[model samples]
Target: MSMFRHLLGVVITLLFVLLTCAVILPILMLALLKVGLPFARWQALCNRWLDWLASLWMDANARHQQLLLPTQLEIEGLDNLSKQEWYMMVANHQSWVDILLLLRIFNGRIPYLKFFLKQSLIWVPLLGLAWWALEFPFMRRHTKEQIARDPSLQGKDIEQTRKACEKFRYNPVTIINFLEGTRFTTAKYVQQKSIYRHLLMPKAGGLAFTLAAMNGQLHRLLDVTIHYPEGIPTYWDYACGRVKTIQVHIRQVPIPAELIGDYTEDAEFRAGFQLWVNQLWQRKDDLIESMKSTGAN
Candidate 1:
C-alpha cells in the first residue's frame, strides 16, 4: 500500500511540475527578453510577474501536500510577518522533504524563498531555467584550499556572489540559507566530530557574505528550526503519510548593527559573527532535544 502511495505521489508531483512549466515557459520567455533589454522598470515589471507565478506554483504544491499528507505540523512565531518586508531566513538541513515543508509553511506568509543555487545546477533542464527566470542567485563558492592555490582569486568570487544579489533590491525577498551546507547524516556527524549532536558545523562565510550584500535593506533574520519527532522523514515517507509530526519554530531576530560588516576584510567582525552563529546552533540543538522530549510537537 505504501509503495503504491509513493508511486501515486510521484505521478502527481510530476504532473504538477509539467502543468506549471507549460503555463510558465511562455511567460518566462517574455520575462527573459525584458531582462535582457536595458529598461529598469520593465525588468522590475517582469520580476513582479515572475513572483506572482512563483507564488501560484508554491500555493498549488502546498494545497497538494495538505490534501495528501495526514501529518500534524506545529508552526509558531510567524504571526507578525509581512509579505512586504525583506527577510534573511536561516535553517538547518535534514532531508529532501525539508524544502517542500518549508514552502508549505511559508506559502503566503512571506515572499517565495529564493535560494543561492550551485552554478552547476544551471544546466538541470527545465528546473534550471525556472530558477533563472525567478532570478535565483547562481553562485560558485571557492574552498579555502582552492583560494590558497591562487591568492588573487580570494575575494573576487565573493564579490560576484554579492553582485548576484543586487537584483533583489527592487522587491521584498526572502533569501534562505542552509547554514550546514548539506543534509545531516550519521556518517557526516562522525566525520566532523560535530560539537552539536543534532547539527553540523555551519559554514558561516556564505551567510556573512549575504548579510554584507543586503546590508541595510534586510529587515530581520528569520531563525527557523525544524524537528521531526518520529525521525527524519524521506520524501517517500512524507508522501506515504508516514511522517506523523513535524515541529517548526520560527523566531524573528532583528539584524543588529554589528552583524552588518565587511566579513571578508574585518577579522574582528568575522570572528564575532562566527561565534554568534555557533552559539545559535547550540541553542537550536537544545531546542531540538526539548521538542523530542515533549509531546507538544
Candidate 2:
C-alpha cells in the first residue's frame, strides 16, 4: 500500500511540475523580454502571473497530498499575518519535505513564499527558470578562502542581493530563510557539537543580508519552528503517508531598530545581530523540547 501511494505521489508531482513549466515558461520569457523596458507596469503584470501560477501549483499539490496521505498538521500563530505585508521569515531546516510543508501550511495565509536559492540552482532545468521568472533571489555566498583569493569579490554578492530585493520593492513578498543553512540530522548535530539538542547552529549572515536589503520594508520577522511528533520524515516517507502529525509554531519577531543597521560593514551591529539570532535559536530549541514532552503524554 505504501509503495502504491509513493508511486502515485511521484507521478502526480512530476505531472504538476511539467504542467507548471508548460504554462509559466512563456510568461517567464515575456518577462525577460520586457525586462529592459522603462515602465514597471509590464513587469508587475508578469509578476502577478507568476504568483498566480505558483499558488495554483501549491493548491494542486496540496490536493494530491490529501488524496494520497493521511497527514495531520497543527499550526499556530497565523492569526496576525497578512498576505499584503512584506515579511522576512526564518525557519529551522530538517528535510526535503520541509519546503512542501511550508507551502501547504502557509498557502494563502501569507504572501507566496519565496526562497533564496543557491546560486548553483540557477542551472536547474524548468523549475530554475520558473524561479527566475517569479523573481526568487539567487545568492552566491563566498567563503573566507574564496574571498582571500580574489579581493575584488568582496561585497559583490551583497550588491547582487540588494538589486534582487529592489525588484520586490513594489510587491508584497514573504522571503523565507532557512537559518540553519542545511537540514538537521543526528550525524550533523554530533559533528557540529551543537548546543541545541534538536537544531543545527543558526547562520545569521543570510538573514542579516536579507534584512539589510529589505531594510524598513520588511517589518515582521517570522521565527518559524517545525517539528514532527513521530520523527523527521524523508520526502518519500511523507509522500507514502508515513508522517501522521506535524507541528508548526510561528513567533512573529519585530525587527529591532538597532539590528537593522548595515550588516556588511558595521562591526557592532554584526555582533548584536548574531547574539539576537542565537537567543532565538536557544528559545526554539527549548520550545521543541517542550513540544516533545507534551507529545509523549
Candidate 3:
C-alpha cells in the first residue's frame, strides 16, 4: 500500500510539472508580444489574456488536487470577496502544500495572488519565467554588512516595492507575503528562540513595507491561518493523499490608516508596527493551540 501511494505521488508530481510547462509556453509568447508592443491599451489587453491563461492553469490544478487528494479541507470567513477589490494576504508558512491549498481555495473567488519571490527564483526553468511575465515582485534583502560595503544597495528593496505597487494600481490584485519569510520547522523554531509555539517570529517589516508601498490602496488584509491537525505535511504527503484533514481560518482585517508609514525611516511607526504584528502572531499561536485540541479527533 505504501509503495502504491508513493508511486501515485510520483505520478501526481510529474503531471503537475507537465501542466505547468504546458501553460507557460503561451505565457512566454504573450510576454514577448507585450514587450514588442509599447502601447498602453495593447499592453493592458495582453495583461488580461495573461490573467485568463493563469486562471485556467490554477483551475486545472485545483481539479487535479480534488480528484487525487482526499484531504478534507474546511475553511471559514471567506465571504463577500471580490475580484474588483485589492487585497493583501498575510499567512503563516508551513509547507509547500500550503501553496496548492491556497490555489485551490481562492482560485476564482478573488483575483490571482501575486507573490514576492526571491530574485534568484526567476532562473527556475518554466515556472520562474511565468512568474516574471506575470509581474511577481522579485526581491533580495542586503545584510547590514553587505550594505556597509556597498552603500548604494541601501533602499533597493524599497524601490522595487514602489515600482511593483505602482503597476498593481492599474489592476485589482491580491498580493501575498508569508510574513514568517520561510517554512517553519522544529530546527528553525528552536534556532530563532521563537516565542510562538507553532510559528517562527513574524517579520513585520515586509508587511509594513507593503502597506506603505500601496499608499492605502490596499486597505483590506486577509489574515490567513492554516492548520494541519495531523502535523504539517510535506508536498509528497499531500500528493499521496496521506493528509486526512486541513483547516483554514481567515480574518478580514481592516488596514488602519496609522499602519501605513515609512517602516525604514520612522522609528515610532516601526516600533508600533512591530507591536501590532507581535500581538497578531500571539493570537494566531493561541488559535493554533485551540485548533489542535479540537481537531485531534
Number of the top TM-score candidate: 3
Candidate 3 lDDT over residue span 145-240, tens digit each: 999999999998788888878878888899999999999999999999999989999999888888888899997999899999889999999999
> Could you tell me how far off, in angstroms, the CA of residue 277 lies in candidate 2 after the best superposition?
0.6
- Residues 156-182 of candidate 1: C-alpha lDDT, one tens digit per residue: 777976897788777889999999998
Please, what is the whole-model Cα lDDT of each candidate in the order they appear? 0.84, 0.84, 0.91
lDDT of 2 by residue, 96-204 (tens): 8899888988888899899989989988877778787777889888889999999999998888888888887778999999998889999999999998889999988
Per-model RMSD to reference? 1.8, 1.8, 1.1
Q: Could you tell which candidate, 1 or 3, scores higher by TM-score?
A: 3
**Which pairs in model 3 have colliding backbones?**
none
- Output the better candidate (1/3) by lDDT: 3
Model 3 lDDT vs. the true structure? 0.91
lDDT for model 1 comes to 0.84
Q: Between which residue pairs do clashes occur in model 2?
A: none
Error of 1 at 216 (Å): 1.4
